[model samples]
Target: MAALRAACYVPRVFTPDAVLIERGAEETPMARRCRERLPDVPFTVVEDRQAARVAIGDDFAAAKRRLVLAEHRGSFLGHCPAGTRGLRCCNYLMMNFATNCPMDCGYCFLQEYLAENLPLTAYVNPGAALAEVARVLDKHGDRRFRIGTGELADSLALDPLTDLSADIVPFFAARSNALLELKTKTDAIDGLVALDPKDRVVVSWSLAPEAAVALAERGTTPIAARLAAARRVAAAGYKVGIHFDPMIEHAGWEEGYRDLVATLAAALPAARVAWVSMGALRFSSGLRRAVRARFPGSPLLTGEQVRSADGKWRDFQPLRVAMYRLVRRYVEEALPDVPLFLCMETPEVWQRVFGAAPLGEQALGARLAAR
Candidate 1:
C-alpha cells in the first residue's frame, strides 16, 4: 500500500527579540535557506518537508519556518475522564506543537475542531514542555497521574520527522508511577521498536472495519498492517491496546467486527493486550454541518443519529447495545482473560453488556499494574 502523502510548509515565522542565532549556525538545508530568504527573521521548521516538496515544489523547503508562540504558566500535566468531549477537554498544557495530520477521515473532528485546516504542526519547544512536565511531576510527586498528547493529534504520526517518541519514551520510562499512552492509526512502529517495551507506556491504535476504512477513512494504514504492528509491539514485550472507537454501524457489522477480532487474536496472544475499548459512533451537532460540507458522500455521517445526554449525536439505545454486545462476545470468545472496557459509555449500557460499571481509573490502573 502507498504511504500517506504529506505537505511540508512553514506555518509562520517569528522574531521574538530573544535567542538570536549566529550567522554560521544557519548552514543546513533548513537553516541556510531560512537565512538567505528571510534574513533578520527568527523561524522554526514545522510541517512535512517531503510532502511539501511534492505538493509545493522543492522551494517549499526554503520557505520560512513556522513558529508557535507559547508559554508554560504553572502545571504542565492535564487530565480527563473518558467522558469528556475533545472540545470540553480543558487539559491544554504547553501546546509546544502545531497541527499536522495527513490522514483525512470523513469523520475526523479536527476538521471542525481546529481553526486552521493544517493537519501537521511542529512545536519547536518540546524541551520546555518536558521541563514543565518534570516540574509538575516533582510538585505533585505524591499523587499518581496520567497524561498523553494523543487527544489533539496522533501521538507519533510525525515521529519520523521530529524524533519525539525516541526522546519522550525514555523520559517517561524513568518516571515509574506516571504512565504515557502513545495512540495512533499509522504503522510507524520502527521508531518505537527499540524502546524498553515496559508497561509504563502503552501503544494504542484506533481500529475500524475494512469497509469503514474504504468508505470513510483516507490515508490510513490498513487494519492488517496496524494489527501486525500491535503484534510486533507485543513481541517486543510492550503492553498493547486496541480501541474500536467511533465504531460505525454499517451493513454486515457483525461479520466486519468478528473478522477484526479474529485477526487480532491470531496476530498476538490475547493475554498480552493491556485493555480493549469499544465505543459506538458519537458526534457533536456542531460537527454535523462540517461533515456534510466536507464529506457529503459518507454514509457514516448520514446515519439516524440523535443527540445524547452529553450533547453529542449517537446511535439509539437498541442499536448501540447490539453493536457493543456483538463486539464483547467476539473479544471474550477470543481472549477471555484480557480486560475489555467501554469508552464514554454510561453505567446502564455497561450493566446491560458487561454486567458491571467500569471501575475507577485508579482501580483499573492497579489491575493493569498487577499484571
Candidate 2:
C-alpha cells in the first residue's frame, strides 16, 4: 500500500477543479485512503480490477491517463529572447507541459509567471504539443534544434505520478534531429531508468551550493540525492547535463561551488556529460516582488541587481562575469573536454568569458550532435 501524496489543498495555488484523479480498478490501500479522505473529489475508479491492481505499482499509469485530457491543444510552446528584449533572440522553444511546482523555491519565477495563483497546471495532453513540435521540425528539418521542458515547470518533479518522461523519452528517441532536454531539481528518475539512453534526450538537473539548497530551496531533493540520480541515469547510458543557473554569491562561495563541482566530477565521468550551463540570478520585477512576499527571509532576493534591457533584474555585469568565469574554470578543471555554455547571456558577456559569441540553439544543437 503506497502512500498517497496530496499535491496541494490551496484553491488558488492548485485548483482542484483542474485536477483529474483516476483511481486504479483494484484500489490499493493508498488509493482507498485517498478516496475516503476526499469523498467529494471527482475520480473514476478503474473497473478492470485485475489490471488496475497490477497498475498500482506502475508509476507511468497516472501520467498515461492524464494525457487523455485534450484541453491544451492550440497553445503551449514559444520562444524567448536573449540579452535584451529587442536585442539578439536565442532560438529557444518552451514546451508548456505543466505549470507551478510542488517544491517551493523562494526565487522561482512561476510565482509571477503563472496567470493563476494555483501552482500546478498539468497539460493533460502532450500528444497535441508533440504534433506541433513535429510540424516545427518538419518545416525546419535542416536546422538543428535545442528545446527544453524545464522552462515552464520542473520537468520531472511530478513524474512519479505523471510518467511524462516515459512518454517524452520515446518521442525524442524516434526524432533523431531534435534534442529534448528534461531539466529537473528532483531525483525522480524511475520513469526514465528503462528508456533508451541516447543523445536525443539529455537529462539535466539544476544545482546550487548545499547552504543555498538548505536555506532557500524548500522541499527539493538534497544535492547528494540529485547527483546520485544523475549518476544512475548516466550509467544507464544517457547523456547527462547540469545547470548552475541563478548561482548565488554568498559567504564562502568559491569553496561551496568547488565542493559541488568536485562531487559532480566524482559521481559521473566527463564522457557521459553532454553540456553544462551557468547562469546568474535574473528575475522579472513582478517575480522579484512575488519572491519577497512569499519568502521574506530569503537572502537571494536581497542582492544588488539592476534591470537589464530585457526588463528583468539581474546581477551587475562585473559580478555576473566573475561568477561565470569561476564556474567555467571549475568545469574546465574537473571535466576538461565537456561542453560548457551560458544561458540567457549577452554576446559581450560571452566574448569576455569564453572569447566567442553565444551560439544560437540550432548551432548549439549541432555542436552537441557532433559531439
Candidate 3:
C-alpha cells in the first residue's frame, strides 16, 4: 500500500532528471518529500548552490530539468522588479521561496535573471521565509499590501514535492493586512486545493491564447486544463485571479483574446474572481537574445517593438494601449464585476486605457489589497 500510494502521487506536471539537495538541506521537509515522491530520480547532496550548479553544468536548458532544494540566504522579500520609475507600477511585494521556474516559457525574463543561478531551486527553510513575511506584515500593519510568490518562480510548479503552499496558505489565511497571490502557468494545485485560505489567498493563472501557448510557452498546462484546475481551486473557497500578461501580439490576436475571455467566463465563476490583469509582451535585450537562441522560430520575436522608457522593449504606446483596451473591454463585458488592472504599464498607457491613472502605486496597492 505504501508503494502503491507513492506511485499514485507521482507528479504528472513535471519529471525532473535529478534532485540536488544543498548542504544541511537533506533533512528538510521539502527534501524528505522529494526523496519519497521522486523515487526514480537520482538524488545527490552538494556543498552548496555553487557546487550544485557545477554538478548540474552550465546548460540553462538542461539545468531546468533538475530540481535543487537549497538554503535561501538574505532577505526573501522585495518589490516587483517591473515597477520601474517610468512605469505606472503596482506596488506589488514579492516573496520568493524559489528562484527559477521549471517550465521553459521561451520569453520569460528569468531566462536572463537566473542565468547566474542556473538550476530550478526551492528554498529549504520556508519557515524562516514565512517568519520574515510575518514580521513585514506586522510592521506595516496600517497599510494594506499585496504579496505574491510567483515573481521569481511559478508559484506552484514544484509544489507537489516542496509542499510550500501547504505551509504558506494557512499562514496567510491568518493574516489580515495582506493578500497572498500564488501565480503560475501550471495546473499543479493539488497542494493548494486542500488548503483553506479564508479569503486571504488568491490563486492566479496566466491565461494566454493557445497560439501563443504553442508558440512560446513550452511545457505549460493547456488552457483548458488550467481553467479546469482553477475551477477546482475556486470551488474550495479561494478567490481566482486572471492575468493575460505578456499578451503576445499574434496573427489573430483580437479573435483569440475574445475567445479566451468567453471561455474563461463560461468556466470560472465570476463571484470567485478577485481580479483580472492584461499586459502586452515587454522584452529586454537580454531576454530577446535568450528567446532568439532558445525559441528561434518564435512569433514573439516578430513583433515590431520599440524600447520603452523603462529600458525594456515593448510595442509602441499606442499599440500596447490598444491591446490593453481591447482585452480589458472583452474581460469587462464578460466578467464586469471583477476589477481589471494592467501589469508593468506606464501612466500614459493607463490613462489611455482607463481614462485615468492610479494616483500612485500606493493607492493602487491599497485598492487591490482591499479586495
Clashes of each: 14, 4, 0
What lDDT is reached at residue 5 by model 3?
Answer: 28
**Residue-wise lDDT of candidate 2 within 247-297, one digit each (tens)?**
888888889999999999999999988888888788888888777776775
Predicted candidate 1 versus true structure: per-residue lDDT over 122-142, tens digit per residue: 444466667877887788777
Alpha carbon deviation, residue 223, candidate 2 (Å): 0.5
Q: What is the lDDT of residue 49 in candidate 2?
A: 29
Clashes of 3: 0
Best by TM-score: 3
Candidate 1, which ten residues in sequence have the lowest lDDT sum? Answer: 5-14
Least accurate stretch of 10 residues (summed lDDT) in model 2? 1-10
Q: What is the C-alpha RMSD of each candidate to the true structure, in Å?
A: 7.8, 8.5, 4.5
Highest lDDT scorer: 3
Which run of 10 residues does model 3 get worst, by summed lDDT?
1-10
Q: What is the C-alpha local distance difference test score of candidate 2? A: 0.69
Q: Predictions ranked by lDDT, top down?
A: 3, 2, 1
**Better TM-score candidate (1, 2):** 2
Which lDDT tens digits does candidate 3 get at residues 1-371? 33332333324457789988887999988899889988899999899999988898878888888999899989999999868768777799899999787777878899888888788888999999999999998898987889999988999888888888889999999999989999988789988888899999999999988877777777777788789999999999899999999888887989999999999999987888989988878888999988888778677878788998878888877788888889989988999878888888877888889998756778877877877
